[model samples]
Target: MTPTFSQLIRSPVLFLAFGFGSGLAKKAPGTFGTLAAVPLWYGLQFLSPLAYMAVIVITFALGCYLCGAASTKLGVHDHGGIVWDEFVGYWITMFMAPAGWLWALYGFVLFRIFDIAKPQPIGWADRKVHGGLGIMLDDILAGIYAALVLQGTAYLISHF
Candidate 1:
């Protein structure tokens, strides 16, 4: 059965899948969802590389289920309001990013672009995949793309 807005907000899984209510925003919910990930990225910055990776893996796994559950509850596939994928995606984009608000901001911008643009394989995955894995794969790919660009930019800035 499709859940109502009130039910979604009250449910723990849905609340998270919805980006802590950021996804509830009527305007640019995806943007807001990505913005919400910034603080989480900052908090995660202190972890060791291995630990960070582990967390990312776990979050990705959980996001698949959380997002899938929320999607099922809402009776829609990849609903705009289901933004846990955005959260995990942004976190992936910022993984091991340089220490600074500037770097975080850059990661945010790049992630949003790649995610929204859905170029090449990312778009392919979006079209071809379904269910929980489908909901998470495209954004994960977008995060990887953004991460590559962000890392490349950081590399250039540091080396030059």
Candidate 2:
């Protein structure tokens, strides 16, 4: 069942899995969910790289269960409303990124592009993987792809 805003607000799991209601958007819920992550990213930006990475690791691990339980309740696989994956994915993309909103915006666009395009193994995982892990895997791949590209671009711009 597609969770209504009321339902999302009422349930803690749904509230989190649905990206605090950003995923309830009628159009491009993933995009909205990713956007929601940007502000939260600011909070983590000050941490040491190791601490930041630790947070991502924890979030990813917890997300598997959070997303899975949510999907089970909704009786759907990878519901668009199930956007906790997007949150973690975007965080991964921004890992070690420059401290600025421009970088954040760039990471957002790159992550979204890779996510929507779903090339190769990312697409493969999306089609083949199951449960919450399945939902998170594709976006994780997309974030990795985007992070490589973003880091490369940042390096080039800095060096040139």
Candidate 3:
């Protein structure tokens, strides 16, 4: 069925709910979904870094509330359409990367690896939490892991 534009913009909760659908894509949907976040991320760039981080924090908080409701409404836990979490998570991933294509590419690869692999704390959060926060926290941690790696990689590349 075609989703209405309103359904597309879903009450804040449903908007995040739609992000989960990205996970449902047959291949590389998560990467594509994360890439979709770039526009929003670009919009956030006008804000000071602190302000940008604050927006991400707020998005995450809202994600938990809305994503949970949408999941229950859809009778699915972490349904694929709830990609707002990915948006937020990936934005957070790019938080520390250098502002360039190369760094963005590295951030994307690292974020995807940590996200898909669910390494360490990410895996723990994925397993222990439920609902929207559970769905989002894993990616947030993965983003953090990606950011750290990207930062370090940048430092190394500069020295070489």
Candidate 4:
């Protein structure tokens, strides 16, 4: 069942899994959830590249558990409200990106496009994977794709 706001707030895991209530938005929860990640990405900017990677690694592990647990609790697979994947995905998109709001915005747009479009292996993982790992794998792939594009764009702009 889709969790009510009260239920979602009351459960710590659900609260995080739902992207700290941003996923509770009535429409386009993934988009809103991704937006919630923007500020976090800003804070993560202060970290050294190695530390930033560590955070992503840890968060990805936690997301697998959280997303899986929430799915089991709700008896739904890949619930729109379980948007922690989007958070991780956006983080990956911004890795090594040029430091600026415009770059962040570009990463945001790119991540969303890849995530929503689900090209190739992303779509395959979404369809074939199961459990929490399954939930995160697709978004991880999307993030990687977006990151490649974002980094490539940065490189091109710098060179040209």
The count of backbone overlaps in candidate 2 is 0
- Candidate 1, residue 95: CA error in Å? 0.9
What is the lDDT of every predicted structure here?
0.90, 0.93, 0.75, 0.95
Number of clashes recorded per candidate: 0, 0, 15, 0
Residues 1-160, model 2: lDDT tens digits: 7888888889998999999999999999999999999999999989999999999999998889889999999999999988999999999999999988899999999999999999999999999999889999999999999999999999999999
Q: Candidate 3 lDDT, tens digit per residue, 49-71?
A: 89988988898898787778777
Off by over 4 Å in 1: 1-5
lDDT of 4 by residue, 50-143 (tens): 9999999999999999999999998999999999999999999998889999999999999999999999999999999999999999999999
Model 4 lDDT, residue 25, Cα? 89
Native-to-model Cα distance after best TM-score fit, residue 65 in candidate 4, in Å: 0.1
Candidate with the larger TM-score of 2 and 3: 2
Q: What tens-digit string does per-residue lDDT give for candidate 1 at 21-108?
A: 8888788888999999899888899999899999899989999999888888888998888889998899999888999999999999
Q: Positional deviation of 62 in candidate 2, in angstroms?
A: 1.1
Candidate 3 regions with alpha-carbon error over 4 angstroms: 1-12, 19-28
TM for every model, in the order presented, reads 0.95, 0.98, 0.84, 0.98
Candidate 2 matches the true fold with a TM-score of: 0.98
* Superposition TM-score, candidate 3 onto the true structure: 0.84
Candidate 4: where is the Cα deviation over 4 Å?
none
